[model samples]
Target: MIKKPVKIQLSEGLDARPIALLVQEASQYSSSVYIEVDQKQVNAKSIMGMMSLTLLPGEEITVVANGTDEKEAAAGIERFLVNVKNR
Candidate 1:
C-alpha cells in the first residue's frame, strides 16, 4: 500500500466533470485507489463516492492505493489532484 498527500490545485475544485474524469483516471489502474479527507475515505473510482467528498481547491487529501500497481495508482491520483491542468 502507498499513501501520498496531495493538495488540490484545481481552480474550480472538484465538480461533476472533474470528478468524472478523476474516476476515469482511477479506473485505469488495477490497484484499489481511495481518497481520504477529514477522516472520510471514498473509492476514487466511484463518481458518487468522490462527489460525496465535496473536495475543494486547497483542501489536502491523501491518495491511497493497495495492489500490484499501488505505487503507480497513488502517484497518478496525486498528479491528477495536484496539477491544475488536469482539472
Candidate 2:
C-alpha cells in the first residue's frame, strides 16, 4: 500500500465533471485506489463515493492505492489532482 498527500488545486474544487474525470483516470489502474479526507475514505473509481466527500479547493487529501500497480496508481492520481487544469 502507498499513501501520498495531495492538495486539490481546482479553483472550484471537484464538481461533477471533475469528479467524473478523476474517476475515469482512477479506473485505468488495476490497483485499489481511494481518497481520504477528514478521516473518511472513498473509492477513487466511484463517482458517487467521491461526491459524498464534498471536498473543497485547497483541501488536502491522501491518495492511497494497494495492489500490484499501487505506486503508479498513486502517482498518477497525485499528478492529476495537483496539476490538471480545469477544462
Candidate 3:
C-alpha cells in the first residue's frame, strides 16, 4: 500500500465541533482510512479513531489508503487537511 504523509497546520476551524463533523463525513468514503498517530494504526474512517488521534494544527499526519479507490481516498483526505480553517 502506498501511503501519503501530509503536514498540516490547524486553525480555529469553526469551533471544535466541526472537526468531529469533518471526520464523520470523511469516514463515509468507500476506501479505507487510517491515521499514523502515536505510532499507531488508527482508523480515520471511525469517529472514535479520528478523535483518539487528537489531531491539531501544525500536526503531521500520515494517511494511508489502500484498495482500488486509493487515489480518491487520498485526495479527499488531502483536501480536507489542507483546506481546514476556522470557517
Candidate 4:
C-alpha cells in the first residue's frame, strides 16, 4: 500500500466534469485507489463517492493505492491532481 498527499491545482476545483474524468483515470488502474480528506475516504473510481468529497482547489488530499500496480496508481493520481492543464 502507498499513501501520498497531494495538493489540488485545478483552477475550477473538482466539479462534476473533473470528478468524472478523475473517476475514469482511476478506473484504468488495477490497483485499488482511494482519496482521503478530513478523515473521509472514498473510492477514487466511484463518481458518486468522489462527488461526495466536495474537494476544492488548494485542498490537500491523500491518494492511497494497494495492489500490484499501487505505485503507478498513486503517481498517476498525484500527477492528475498536480498538473491541471494536462487533464
Q: Please, what is the TM-score per model?
A: 0.93, 0.94, 0.78, 0.94
Candidate 4: where is the Cα deviation over 4 Å?
none
Residue pairs in steric clash, candidate 2?
Answer: none
Please report, as a residue range, the 10-residue window in candidate 3 with the lowest summed lDDT: 9-18
Candidate 1 global CA lDDT score: 0.87
lDDT (tens digit, per residue) of candidate 1 on 2-33:
98989988777888887888999999999999
Better of 1 and 3 by lDDT: 1
Q: Write the per-residue lDDT of candidate 4 for residues 1-87, one digit (tens) a residue.
A: 999999999777888887888898899999999999998999999999999988887889999999999999999898888875575
Give candidate 1's error at residue 6 in angstroms: 0.4
Of 2 and 4, the candidate ranking higher by lDDT:
2
Return the top candidate by lDDT.
2
lDDT of 3 by residue, 1-87 (tens): 658887765664223465576576566677777778657887776666666666666777788888778888888777777776633
Q: Give lDDT tens digits, candidate 2, residues 1-87.
A: 999999999887888888888999999999999999988999999999998888788999999999999999999999889876744
**Model 3 / residue 65 / CA error / Å:** 0.3
Clashing pairs in 3: 9-58, 10-57, 13-86, 14-86
Task: Give the range where candidate 2 is weakest over 10 consecutive residues by summed lDDT.
Answer: 78-87
lDDT of each: 0.87, 0.91, 0.69, 0.90
